[model samples]
Target chain A: MKKDLNITPLNTLSLVDKVEMRITQYIKDNNLSVGDTIPKELQFAEALGVSRTVIREALSRLRTIGIIDSKKHKGMVLSHPDFIQNFEKVIDTNLLEDETLKDIFELRLILEMGMVDVLFARKTKEDLKELEEIVDRMETNNSESTIFKLENEVAFHGKLYEMSGNKTLQRFQNLLLPVFQYVHEHKLPDAEPYKYSKKFTTHRELLNYLKEDDIKAFKKGLSNHLEPHLDRILEKSKS
Target chain B: MKKDLNITPLNTLSLVDKVEMRITQYIKDNNLSVGDTIPKELQFAEALGVSRTVIREALSRLRTIGIIDSKKHKGMVLSHPDFIQNFEKVIDTNLLEDETLKDIFELRLILEMGMVDVLFARKTKEDLKELEEIVDRMETNNSESTIFKLENEVAFHGKLYEMSGNKTLQRFQNLLLPVFQYVHEHKLPDAEPYKYSKKFTTHRELLNYLKEDDIKAFKKGLSNHLEPHLDRILEKSKS
Candidate 1:
């Protein structure tokens, strides 16, 4: 096991982590505005009291995360923040076991349920029209089989995500596609009643809520719409 | 913008991803059990039609993820199946942005809400005792300050995470702390209902529900507990 002792600063980290933390500290300490250009490599290393090799390793990670854009001739420029950078690493390390998967599963459910209020509040006419088209396409397909339902399923949920108008939530919903697939494939249950009947009812209600700007009723309807899925999910957890 | 056309695979990746995939595939293909020693790097690369560099990169990533263990002389031995291996590169890269943060926020909310059932279902006598102790300690403080409340707040919610019996969720809850701190610092409203009461009735109710094993009541109570924060979150989103 890797000991957690506080060793001397010289060779403390695995060279990579040491370098990475220095850059992180730089960003944090300098309060460098997003998109700011990072200091020159040799300068940064000198400032941090580390080697160029360490700085380079740290910068490589930052570049990977889109935090700093690196070019051949030019130095690093600050870019947008990226959260999936760490998530991807965690996943790549194959470290998230059954326990983590369950955590992710719960996360998906929470986001799905919480989105209703936002969806109704922010959805647009164009979004509603799109939903109608997706629902129409969905209605034309046979419902008994899941394979045929894949596209429509994504369409409906994707529309819901879009309606929520939270781009972050949308990306998260997309990222969870892998875990979602795993759960869906391994432990799928029958479509709850609301999934068929109330799906349209809730959609119409939600769209109307959006048009009318009924925040109170919208929240209620959102909760009601998600009630069935909550039950189904809880039941699955038990079994 | 990083045009997809501008993207090129890293030098180390060609051999790495394929080697990793092939190794996993070989294990499955050959029905190799855990503790199975993978073929020597060169031989394995030859069999999989790849270079040793690629195999090594793959092995390196896998090793990092804890899927396979490799020592100086022990060679590489298959470890447990880990799904999180997919996320290492993601984490290493700096791609999460505002949209992704929002997604993570919503995701955290979803996970928090979904955890209610898990909390109640899996609560033990000891768990309840520990929660009671934390709340009891929280009751001693009269401060409404976020920093002051943080200690107790984390304890109470951390207990909930533990009850969910999901380590990933627990670690994730910890991982997202900085983001949560950012939100609390920037967005949360400081309002009334704090001068007289400790304003943690919901936690008491949650404890009651956990003790009684009332899943419905527990969820309701938890939602009520979260409602204030959720309202503030929504309001913050607007502003």
Candidate 2:
């Protein structure tokens, strides 16, 4: 109770707003199971002494993020999985601008660099097998065109991210996919794809290291994979 | 047009919904000056053959991020000096969860680490003076409570971020403030404050290095400042 003295109270909410926060907090506090119906909107709103419209807007935003689902007859239910699904739409609709793209691109690299330990710690044989197949496809593709290699490149490393078992990190990587594609498509030709290819061979080496669970080598491999991407962007900036 | 064909489109916006894209393109194409008003909403919407509502929605999203500002009488103008303000609200709302917080925290470190290069590139006597004052205060108030010290810690680093003179990076550092606060608030008790004080001394050393524009030492100092924070987080995780 004494500690509570140091904590400021949250801002006051309207009666309708109170009902909304109550429900959202209820879900979080109770760890509400997905697909379970929340209280009936009318019943819930009335119980909180708020109008239905106020409850509707809050629920609408939650539903917009896939945190809940609503049906005319069935009412509101919690169904939110990953919050990134909501963030993805916000970014995709041109809300995210050029600078945000660049910042996010840097964000992706930082995540990748930090992910090495996690990737090696949790990597599975099945994960390595998938990565090998992706690398094989990358080598066989003759065209210098980035478009062809970009998706495979994302997949190979994406699997590595999944190996981290950090769902949020994996989803964050995928969320930055558009920016990555934009960066790849507009990339300068000075950094040879040949150079990038050799670097990606490190991913295979990384897989080997992961099999042994070598944290040092795995970090080095992940860092090396990101180096060219960072270098290419920086180099493009100068040119 | 042929170049456009070479690039695969990654979005699903209808032409009407693509008004934001068109607006951005128009700004880049014409090299429109900042603070320039956009074409009349109705005219632009009609030319693009989209309803005013669609155009308005696109513009509103841009406005929310400080990319553009609208006046009831003056119409919409390109006014954004930075894009981070929008993200601040989202960050404050606790939209980013645990792992996203870690990713963001790493991002702050990357910026702090990368900043040595930029700092020397753009250092000034005034910046050095201000940073020293912050460090001096940290030393003078060795008995400062954790809450007060933590608040000053961000302020000091945030000042460093501002000194880098990169608007994009500064905004990001600010946007990540909530995540940084979250990490710092929950860390181990006894050793952290001491190690954190070492970071302040490193910050002073970084300023000395910056005064000489010695990037190598500045980089070393930057890394030193960040090491304790990272280690503190890492150590807490192990326990």
Best by TM-score: 1
For candidate 2, write residues A1-239 as lDDT tens digits: 67669664566344534664687677656756656778876876777777787676556545434456665677776653343543554444433456556656655665676555445545678987787788778778847587777777777778877776666657767877876776556533446576665536355676677777677666556656667766665554445
Q: Record all residue pairs in model 2 with backbone atoms less than 3 Å apart, i.e. clashing.
A: none
The sequence of per-residue lDDT tens digits that candidate 1 reaches over residues B202-238 is 6778787788778767666666677656666566667
Q: Give the worst 10-residue stretch by lDDT in candidate 1 chain B.
A: B85-94
- Output the chain A TM-score of model 2: 0.67
Find the candidate with the highest DockQ and give its number. Answer: 1
User: Per-residue lDDT of B1-239 in model 2, one digit per residue for the tens?
Assistant: 66668565657455534786787677667766556787877987888888887776566545534456666788877663343433543444453456566656655665575445445545678988888888888778769898778767777888887885666667777877777767656533335565464325455676677777786566556655666666654554456
Deviation in Å, model 1, residue A161 alpha carbon:
2.3
Poorest 10 consecutive residues by lDDT, candidate 2 chain B: B80-89
Q: How many residue pairs clash in each candidate?
A: 40, 0
- Candidate 2 Cα errors over 4 Å, as ranges: A1-83, A94-96, A114-133, A140-146, A184-239, B1-129, B163-169, B183-202, B205-239
